[model samples]
Target: MLAGKYSTLGAMPTERTFAMIKPDGVRRGLTAEILRRIELKGYRTVGLKLYQIPRETAESHYGEHSAKPFFGELVDFITSGPVVAIALEGENAIAGWRSMMGATNPANAAPGTIRGDFATSVGENVTHGSDSPESAQRELALFFAEGELLK
Candidate 1:
């Protein structure tokens, strides 16, 4: 399937999940490996693209974290290089991607995960996944224009 818009169960796929490879992932050439894992998990990629996030977009995307000390660093890191953003469809995909991504800090992440396999620091965790369904929808809207990623 191109972008997995649903699962076999036909539960209507609660909500879409959004994921993005950080600058480090692109610089290290881990994009294929990361996408492979997502495909292997049986989820469908509804949308995929390689683009550099503008500073404004990055700021809005991480706006909730603006008050945090690392917010500026987060924005800068995300905009530092090209990133691959994906829209995934499947049951519980938001949570699933988060699990697949492991912990926020690679040091705490379990082995056999994308972060565990490639990341070395919390700031460069390699990928970003939607924390909730609402955010997933919001983020999908932010990164993908209408019809940009098909189901």
Candidate 2:
């Protein structure tokens, strides 16, 4: 019955993606729910950790937005509280995670999405998912070292 879930090529190639339950999500006690959703979608958690992000690491993680006006606020918020870093592996992991996250702005997200259901604003959205495979590799490296990821 579940045979059509993927494609004729059999299961899609497994890929890893990076995700972070942001400060607001942690402060609001939504970590379990978020991770549960990921697991329920059939992805495997290869790596996980709870830690306060250092300023230097935060800056590097968000380097692409360094020139943006909200860059300071972005870094400040992420570094403000403890966050849960997650590395999830599965087929189409990057896009799947992003779809689960919904729109960047909660106001614009659909009703069933994580952001649509829990987030209040763009600045304090519940979670972060890498937008592409390249970003995933980069972000996973930032949050998790080679040894941290399960083979």
Q: Residues 49-112, candidate 1, lDDT per residue (tens digit)? A: 9999999999999999999998999999999999999999877898899999999888889999
For candidate 2, write residues 28-120 as lDDT tens digits.
Answer: 999999999999999999999997999999999999999999999999999999999999999989989999999999999999899999999
Worst 10 residues of 2 by lDDT: 1-10
Regions more than 4 Å wrong, model 1: 1-14
Report the CA-based lDDT of candidate 1 relative to the real structure.
Answer: 0.90
Clashing pairs in 2: none
How many clashes does the backbone of model 1 have? Answer: 4
Q: In candidate 1, how many Å is residue 128 off?
A: 0.4
Evaluated at residue 8, the lDDT of candidate 2 is 55
TM-scores for the candidates: 0.90, 0.93
